[model samples]
Target: MGKRFENKVVVITGAGGVLCNAFAAAFAEEGAKVALLDINEEAVMQNARMLTEKGCTAKGYKADVLDQESLKQTRERVNADLGTCDILINGAGGNNKRATTDNEFHDFDLPEDTKTFFDLDKSGFEFVFNLNFLGTVIPTQVFAADMMGKKGANIINISSMNAFTPLTKIPAYSGAKAAVSNLTQWLAVYFSKTGIRCNAIAPGFLVSNQNRALLFDADGKPTARTEKILRNTPMGRFGEADELLGGLFFLADEQQSSFVNGVILPIDGGFSAYSGV
Candidate 1:
């Protein structure tokens, strides 16, 4: 049997990260020529090399999602090497510590010595917003051009569960991902006639290098917050990176989901559906 993405071209940003890397490998295994883009030149190249070793057509590009010039150049190179991008995975976004507060809420009964909202740094807020929001927009602007009028062309933006219900400390990431979700809908309508579908995947709490410290303790055990997450999640555990692959393949394959657009599919193991009842 032929692969689902046989002879297709797919671009994944932040392709070096664990989750995106899983997406890249999954797509490549199905015969897609993968363009792995990441700000970390070494990491992306390493990922590309690993894919190539597996007899997959893959290439790595060093492009900062926040830099329009770099993104345009990278897009041009990708087009020249692989065909016009048919599928784009906007996976290059994360939260910074600066925009996150140490505590969930402000303590009113403190002796004038508690860290509060006033402690939030301006640069931190800007960094988180730009990284998560603009990081997505800039890449979409550069790559979606290749998808215009192309059959089976689609774009998947990566959102977070916090986008639907704001988490405790990371306000900026929540808002930015919410904007991403909203943008996904807007673009779906904006490009309805162009044969390009726009949608988003809101992942629930998943353990990664970015959030391992927050989710696990020094002893490699689940933290209090992690416990809370599992308790609220109907699945009763964190998601594995491979769990997202099925939804990704469905969205990327127009034959499977031709009518699906402007939707945010929460691959959170029912975390979004549960109300902690």
Candidate 2:
């Protein structure tokens, strides 16, 4: 409605998911031509169609963030469809159950079937790491080419609370997101002279479709982990997907965030501030 991004092309990875879909709609509402990139071809295309029905300039493409070649191809298609990307949001990443320990603590008497730290699979760690870290790196590599020297170019990476501190049960995701935060700072400095600003959003506990299983039990009651999370979070509630738009829009807008770079903004409702004391 503000038209802050009028005529600008915005690219969002994981565009089919709960959080990223909200991002896509928000950008489109702000008058940006949005390119929704996701590994789920059908879902992404469906989202694209819905946006089209709303008269928003939007399209969807199949992309695997870990696949550099696929990203390059996506860039080409997006350029041809919606023009060059001025804003890039790397939102494709998730924690796999395999990469998560079965229990939060170590005990010798734990069930043999439980996946403890010692029983963690290298492949699982590799999968989660590649999905979160390389996912952001490869897309930036492919798309940042168009952003160089371009006015109002901004790149926003998605980080998690685990990036600031290791979260229990998901070591691989924690490490990978930490890498993402580190890489975000590196890119901001590397592209400082190119007129491109890179930053990240480290979100706290939010109930998205991706992590719903872990947050809720089979009977739909909040799990013990969810209770712990809410107790630790000062806000005592999970963030809604739309709540991220303010920070995102601010960072993406040149007038608003021209001097803001290399910083990881936490929209966590003060979850990071709590010391559990």
lDDT of candidates 1 onward, in order:
0.92, 0.93
Query: Which residue window of length 10 is worst by lDDT in model 1?
Result: 108-117
| Runs with alpha carbons beyond 4 Å of true place in candidate 1 | 110-114
TM-score of each: 0.97, 0.98
Tens digit per residue, CA lDDT, model 2, 101-215 = 8899899899878888888889999999999999999999999999999999999999989999999999999999999999999999999999999999998888877789989
The ten-residue window of minimal lDDT in model 2 covers 111-120
Q: Which candidate is the best by TM-score?
A: 2
How much RMSD separates candidate 2 from the native structure?
1.1
Tens digits of per-residue lDDT for model 1, 156-183: 9999899899999898899999999999
Candidate 2 regions exceeding 4 Å error are: none
Q: Cα lDDT for residue 17, model 2?
A: 91
lDDT of 1 at 110: 54
